[model samples]
Target: MDKSVDLQHYYLELSPEPVRFDAVSQLTNVFFDDAKQQVFAVRSGGATGIVVKSATDGQNISFCMEDRGTIRSIKFSADNQVLAVQRNDTSVEFVPFNANNQPNVPEMLTHQGKNIIYGFVWVQERQVALISKAGVEIFQLNFEKRTLKSVKSLNITVNWFSFCPTSNFALLSSNMGTILTPVILKASTITKLPRLELGTSQGCSGRDVTLAQLYGTNAIMILRQLQNRQFEVVIYLLNGPGLAPKKSHILRLGQSGRFAMNIVDDVVVVHHQASATSMLFDIALGGAETEVGSGAVIHQPIIPAKTIKPYTLEVPSMSLDGKTINCDLYSQHWVLFQPNIVIDAKLGCLWHVLLKLNSLCALITDRFRLVEFLLQRTEGKPVLLNVLKEMMSVNYSGTMLPVIESIFNKLNCLYKSVLDNELQSQMALMALSTKSQSSKLSPVPRVIVDQSDAYTGVFSSITDTEQLGKILLLYLHSLARNGITANPELSKQIVIDLVRNKQFDTLHQLLKYSALNESKPLACFLLSLSNSDPSISQMALDMLARLNANEIILEVLLEKGQVVEALRIAKQMPGADSLPARKYLEAAYKTKDPLVFHSVYNFFQAKNVRLRGSPDFLKHEQCTEYVQYYQTLISTQCL
Candidate 1:
C-alpha cells in the first residue's frame, strides 16, 4: 500500500474562487498589507478611489482620495483610523477618518533625518515604522490631533527590511543584504535582537530575504539563484539564548526560475514561476548532510513538483463583462506574499493557496518520512491515524514489516518526547510554588499518537480477532522496545489471543520479559487455563509468586489437593500462626490419601510443638477433629 500515489499528485490546490477586484485597469496599483491580510488597490494613483478588501472578512471598504503626487508607499494604520501615504523620499502624510470614514485634512510628517525612506510598516494599532537607508524610525499616530509623534529610533545602515507579523519581529538587512539585524516592535516598544552576517558569495536582493516563523522557530530565509540558474533557500534559526543566527537548513531546490515561498503548516512550499508548480519541503524530514562548512543540512522537496489544482474564478468583473472566467494561475503579474497569499495585480485577483493534506499521504513514497513529516503538522495526527487503518486493511506482506516498524518507532519517539516534556514540566512546578522554573518556550512539531490511540483507531476495529491479536503482539513489542508500557487491558488481550492460538513460546517470552502486567486477576485467569496447558498455569503461578500473592497461591494449592505445598507456603509466609492449620488437614482428609493425611497431620504437629512447647494438637488448635478424621481414614485403609 505504500507509495500508492495519486495519478496527478495533486498535493496543492488553489481556492475555488480567486478574490476579484478592478484589475482591468493597468493604471491601478495593488499593495498587500501582510499585517492585516488586506489587499489595497489605488486606481490611477488614487484619483479613481482607494479600494481596501480583507481576505478574512471578504468585505470591501472604498474611500475617495484626492490626487496624491506619485504615491510611493501606502497602508492603513493597524486600526484603520488613519491612512498613511508616502509620496516623497522622506515624508509620509497621515489622513485620519471621521465617524463616517471620510478622510480629514492630512498631516505631513517627515523622516528623522535626510535618509531616504525605503519602506514603512504598521507596527501596532497606532504605531508605524519607517525603514530608511540608514535606520528605522517608529512613530505613534495621534488620530485625535491628526498628527504623528516620534517614539523610538535606531541608526544602522539598512538595505531592506522584512517583517513577520506572526513572530512580531522585523529583519533589517544591510551591506548589500548580507548583514541582518532583527527587531521586535510590539506594545509600543522596539527591542533589538542579535545581528547576523551572511557569508554568501553574493548577497540576496531585498525581495529574496524573507522572515517567517516555521514550526515555532523564527527563521530568516534567503533565496539565492545559483550560477546555473538553480535556486536554494538558506534558513537560519533565530532561537536559543543569546545565540547567533545558525544556518541550520538549506532547501535544495533543483529547478531554476523565479521562486516564492509560503510556509503552510510549518511545511515550506516553494512556488516556481516557470514550472507553475509548488514543491514542498519539511525541515523535520532527514536529508543529505552538509553542503557548506556551516554544516547546514540540505533537504529535498517532500514530493515531486505538482501543479496547483485548477480553479475557476466566479466573480464577474468589469473586464469579464459579468461572466465567469478561467484565470491563469502563476501569471506574469502574479505576486507571491509571505505565508500563503498569491495575487495577480493585472487581473486584480487574489487567492490563498491551500494544501491538500490527505492528498499528501498518497504523494509521499517513503512511509517513514511521511510519518516523520506528518507528526509535526498541526492536523497530522488524524491523518496519520487514518493511515494506520489503511495499513491494517491492506494484505500483509514481508515488505510491509519494515514500514510498520518505522512508523511504530516514530510514534514511540513522539510519545516519548511528550512524556518527557510533561515530566519536566511537573518537576519544574515542584521547584516553584506558583510558577514553572523552565525558560524555553518554543514550539516543537510533534504528532501525539500513543499506543492506546493506535489500538482503538486501528487494531480494535479489525473484525478478525485472531489476526488482530497477532498484530497487537507486534505493536506491543514495538512499544516495549521503546521502553514504553502498554495498558493492562491491551496486555491481556494479546495474551488471550496467543493462548487461543497455542503460541506458548511467544507467550512465555511475553511473561519472561515482563511485557505483560502482573495482577491477581490475571494470575487467576492463567490458573484457570491449567487444564488446557500446565506450563501456562505454571507461568501464572510463577507470576503470582513474584507478586507475593500468598492467599491466592494457597487457595489454588489446597483446591488441587496439594496439602503439603499449601501448608508449606502458609508456614513460610508471615503470620503463619494465624493461618488455619485445621483447614489444610480437612482438605487432606477430603483427598482420602493416607500418605497425604499423614503429611498434613505431621505439618501441623511440628507447628504445635514449636509454638506450644509440645508436639500435640492443642484444644484451640482446631486440628483434633481433622486428626480424628485422618485416624478413621487410616483405619479404613487397613481394612
Candidate 2:
C-alpha cells in the first residue's frame, strides 16, 4: 500500500505582485469606489479631509472632500459620483464629484437640530437613506441640478444601520444600549423586528455590546460580554425568506484583558491582547438537529453542532511585551497585523505567501529584511530553507535562480579549498616519514623481514571511510530536507567513485540512511560488489535482513547452487517451505534432468523416515514418487 499523502496541504499560494497603500495618519475609515477607479480614505482630528487616490497603485489624485470639520462617517453613492459626509457637530452634507473625480462645493442637508445622524446607506443610484437618533430619512440627489430633496422620513431612533452584502434587506438597530426592538428595511417600508439578544438584559449590563451584519448573507452576529467576564457571539438569521437562528460561541480573554474580532467567509476570528493565539469558529446557515424528547418550545439556544479547529500563527512580541495584534477582513483577505510584520491568511496556500513575500522583499529593497522577518516569525526553526524552496520553485522570472546557484557555488568552492588543504598536509607528513625511515634502512635476513600494514597501493589515495561517510551523510540530509534535487547523473558518479575507490563501508553506511525507494538501485549495486569481499558481503546481507528482503536472499543462495542451505532457511519460515519443495519437484518430474536425482530423492526419503507413524507422515509421501521416478530413469539408462 502506498502511504504517501498529497503535499498541497502543507504550503500556501501567494500572488507575485501585491498592492500596498501609504500610511494615513489618524485614519478612521477606508472605502473603495470601483466605478470612479479611486479609493477614498477619511481621517479624523487634525487637517481632516477625504484623500483620494488611484485604487490600482494608491497614487494620490486631484480629488478631495470639501468638509473641513471632523468627519463622523463617510459613504459613497451607488454611482460613485456622490459623497455623503457626517460631522461631529450634528451636520450632514452631500458633495457631488464630476467625471474627473473632482468634488464640487458641498450642500448642507442637516435637520437643523431636529435630528442627529447615526449612520447611512445607499439603497439606489441618485438616492440615499440616512439613520439618525430621531428616525430614518430618504433623500434624492438631483445630479444635473446638484441639489438634494427629502423623499421620506421615519420617527425612530436608529443607533446603527447597514445593508446586507448579498440580499437587498437592510438591518437597523434602534438603540445601542438596553434591550430594544430593531427593524428591517423592505423596499421603502420599515417594519419592527425582534433583536437577536445573546443574553438577558440583566446579564448584559456593565458589558460592551456590539452588532454587525455578516458579509454575503442576511445573517447578523450579536457580540456581547457578560457581567461575569465571558464573551459570547450569537448569530441569527434575522431577515430574508426562511431565516432562522444558526449557532452560538464563547470566547476567553487573557493578558491585557481585551480582545478584537472579525468575520470572514462565514468564520469569526478572535485575537486577545495578552497572547499570540487566536480562535476561529465556523457559522453556517443550515444544519440538521439532533433527536431529543418532544416538549414545549422553550426558546433556549441550540449550541452549534460543528466546530472549526482554531488556526494558530506566531506573532512577534505579542506575549512578551503585551503588544496587541490587529485583525481585519480587507477585500476578503484576513490580515493579521503585528509590530514589524503582516501575516495574511492567504499565506495558508504555499504559492501565495511566497509570491507576496518576494514582492515585499522587493518593495523593501532588502532581502535580509524578509529573511529576518521569516526567521523571527518561525522562531528560528529550520523552515528558512523550506521558505526558500517555495520561493525558488515557483519563480519564473529567471531572477532568483542565479542568486541561489551563485550562493551554492561559493559554498562548494570553500569546501573544495578545505579538502585540498587537508590533502596537502597529509602528503607532507608522508614525505617526512619516508625520509626519516630511509636513514635506518637496512637489509635483514629473509626469515626476519618486516612489513607494515600501511596502504601504499591503488587504495592509498582514498580518504578515511568513516569521515567521508559523515560528510556525505550531512550533504545528502541537507539537500533532502530542503526538497532540492541535485543532478541525478552527478549523484550516480559520486556513488560510482566511492565504490571504485574501495569505500564500501562508507557506501553501506549511506545506504542505511537513505529512503527505501531511493535506495533500491544502490542496494542492487552493493549486492553485486559484495562478492569481492567477505566483509562487504556480510554487510550487504545484514542490511537486506533488516529490511525483510527474504526473496532476494533466497535468490542469492539459489543462484550459487546452495540448495540445502536454501531449504534449511525456507523451512524455518512458515509458509515458505513450498517454494524449495516445488523447485526440487520440477527438477525431477518436469525437466527430467537426472544427473543428481539421488540427491533430491534422498532429501524427501529422510523426511519420510523422520515422520514415520506421525500425524504428518503423509507429508513425505512425495518422497516415494521421487524414489520411483529416479529408479525408472536409471532403468532407462538416462541417469
Candidate 1's TM-score:
0.82
Counted clashes in each candidate structure = 0, 11
- Winning candidate number (lDDT): 1
Candidate 2 residue-wise lDDT at 479: 47
User: Which ranges of candidate 2 are over 4 A from the true structure?
Assistant: 1-19, 26-39, 42-49, 53-61, 65-67, 106-113, 143-147, 159-171, 174-176, 180-192, 197-217, 226-228, 239-256, 284-639
lDDT of 2 by residue, 1-639 (tens): 121221222111222333333333445445443223344466555444556555344456444443376666666665656777776645667777778877766443443346666667676676776677777777777756656677776776666554442444445554353343445553355555555433445223212333344434345444555577665554555545443334433332322345444443233455444443344443332223322442211121112111121233333474775543323322134433211112232322111122122222333333433343333222222333434333343232345544444433333333344445566666666788464532332222111100011112111223433344544554455444444443344345455666677777776676667521233454456567766665555555666667677676666655555555656676677675244444554454543446544555566556546556332224444444655576787799875
Candidate 1 per-residue lDDT, tens place, 447-491, comes to 688767886677656534334434555677778777787777766
Every candidate's CA RMSD: 4.8, 24.8
lDDT of each: 0.77, 0.46
Global lDDT for candidate 2?
A: 0.46
Determine the backbone clash count of candidate 2. 11
